[model samples]
Target: MKANGPFKILALLFVTVLAFYLIAYHTIEGRRNRNGPWIVAFTNDLSGAPALRIDHPALAITNVQLVFPDAMLPTNFTAKTILFQRPRPVPFPLPMGECIFMDTTFLPGSVVMRMSGHEVQLIPRVLTINGREQPWKSGETIALTAILTNAISPRLNGR
Candidate 1:
């Protein structure tokens, strides 16, 4: 009877923790998918500075400047692309900036780009540019594009 009591308590604790985790995960996923998937692209502007462009089936946003802390910029001048499937984590209860777009909850994740004959992959928390991997900084601002048609690929200016 004593052994069963400890086992039951441990089982109950595990179940409670799992339930809380699942609830949180579902809530986040719900918020993320509310706006559907967005495609994000990063490329150099006319002045050779990095610029962000977003494309959605229902919205058109472009020429957004990506502000980085301490002037940190991507070393490669080529274009990078990512599919945003999750909501960007916010530190405040309410967003601080103006709501330019309807959904501002997406983040760039699992990206791939080509630069100078090298394959670059930008996964969450990891950045691989020119075949070299580095830690993706949190201070860097992210941007994304959107997919509208099944035949067209998600890219800026068709590559």
Candidate 2:
């Protein structure tokens, strides 16, 4: 035999690196793509989540009619820091997973927008309208529209 000690050592090292890359490395990469914190709107339809009627006395909304004056709503993206704010924020960024739905319906895992390491998840809760100082009921089938945008980076907004 030719006593290929160096070759065996190199081969073993390569295998070890491969295992780390394939098993341990879960793509916990940098925050280069973070652009989120979108305040989106959704009804109480689980099919098109971002819903807000799951916790109300009524389990569904009726006679729902949505309208968008500009055919789009803007997304609100915040800083991508560990100091996140919200209820049931997504642990990962967008493109990984999200909720997408039409102006009048709901969709699950369709990420309306994202920030740092969290996402704007729609759930059943009383939402306060700043303009009217009104609190939206949990199961009310109000006409609504949601538009996703990247306030931080317009390029990511995708026109």
Candidates in order, TM-scores: namely 0.32, 0.26
- Predicted candidate 2 versus true structure: per-residue lDDT over 43-90, tens digit per residue: 324333223221222323222222222222225422221211233543
Q: What lDDT score goes with residue 108 in model 1?
A: 35
lDDT, candidate 2, at 31:
27
Residue lDDT tens for model 1, 38-139? 455655555554454444442333322342222223454457664456444432111111111222344433434432223345344455544667654434
Model 2 stretches with alpha carbons more than 4 Å out: 1-3, 26-66, 69-159
Alpha-carbon RMSD, each predicted model = 15.7, 14.9
Give model 1's TM-score versus the native structure.
0.32
Candidate 1 lDDT for residue 45:
50
How high is the lDDT of residue 154 in model 2? 65
The stretch of ten residues in a row with the least summed lDDT in candidate 2 is 101-110
